[model samples]
Target: MARTPFDAGAEFDRQVRVLTDLGYPELSGLGPERFGALVAPLRARAMAAQESRYEPGAGAGDEGRVPFLLVVSRNVAPIEETMPRTVLHGGRLPGFVDRTFEPGSLERFVATEETLLPDPDAYLLFDIERGEEFCGVVPRDAMKAIAGRDRTLLTIEEGIALVTHFPQVLVKNKCFSLGGSRCGDRRVPAIWISQKAPKLGWCWEGNPHTWLGMASAGTRTGGVA
Candidate 1:
């Protein structure tokens, strides 16, 4: 399949905005020169990490649910596709899933048996501690159920809704709270969705860059956080 080229500059700006929105004030102080010098390379690496040949719903037809595991422990049996987990840190505001996830650079999940799992188009993200409570979500009709919803189906708000559907999980993104007060890591929310949901796939609109910078902590050059 033909692919779209990665846009580093645009991604850099998007990440910069993501950082600023996450309450890192230092990014606002950096000139373009400094940011390009330090942060751009990191962004490039992130872009590289997310590179994959997978296309959304490529092989996914209206079929059985994609097996998903809500793994909270760093040490867990490897699943087929390693869902990228993101931390909603102690002092951050969560508006959308993209905003919350844009900072969690990629993690190291090794798959011991690649033959046993589905060639998943995307991975679901969950924090180590917060995700422990979840067993997994098996959609009644994985593809049909998700495809019916609006585009907002993949946002953090909706993602939380899906998680809270399971018993014993109560969560609210800070953006919806009264004062937007900081919540400790324990209170941080985790998003668990069916592995079959095409909306959550790592490949976005024919480009695999969606998850590239998903985990970077921003550039470290010149003390410009």
Candidate 2:
């Protein structure tokens, strides 16, 4: 039998139905949703940045030459020398970034040197490296938690996890809070790096950085980007 061609539109509708049946709130939430508006621009920006770094017939080792963009508000201060170097990009960053990383102390989760920005209210972060592009936005509260060494919001591992698998972590939490059981007993949900979730492409959850009181691994004293 001939295989049916994959219809992106139809596949998208199916995913929508799955999340909708699970009582996804933003789908029925009120007010003009501005966060959802950032998806296209973010993806485009990520792709463009990646394309600019591409070299024809370059070997795999050349991948390291491609830099990741860590766009943020101009008002945001530069990362201090005392603090570990990490962009800590958050929000709906898609999973395609895994350039180079290693486990470290609580103070250094998803650590990467960031290129600061002057754009105000800049939330999305594009982890463009080679062909992978991940969407992310750092929550102000989480930043505060790291600064204040607040143990209540998130732990080092959780914080790292947040940076690693953003909107999914947010969505997974919401699902359980509303009695939805996609993640079973896990509150934040486990998203292994090797196993990528199907790209929903469209934004279903709002700014993940806006959510509050989320911590990982019982909290430890530290600060991050």
The most accurate candidate by TM-score is 1
Q: What TM-score goes with each of the models? A: 0.24, 0.23
In model 2, where is the ten-residue run with the lowest total lDDT? 173-182
Error of 1 at 174 (Å): 12
lDDT of 1 by residue, 1-225 (tens): 744544433434554454334332332344445533433434443334335422333221012111111111122211111122222323122222323323332132122231121212112221111211112222212212333431111222223222222212212311111000112221222232222221122222112121111110111111112
What is the lDDT, from 0 to 100, of the residue 220 in candidate 2? Answer: 19
Q: Scored by CA lDDT, what does every candidate get? A: 0.24, 0.26
Q: Against the true structure, whose lDDT is highest?
A: 2
Query: lDDT tens digits, residues 82-132, model 2?
Result: 012222224322343232322222123222122122233223322211111
- Candidate 1, residue 92: lDDT: 28
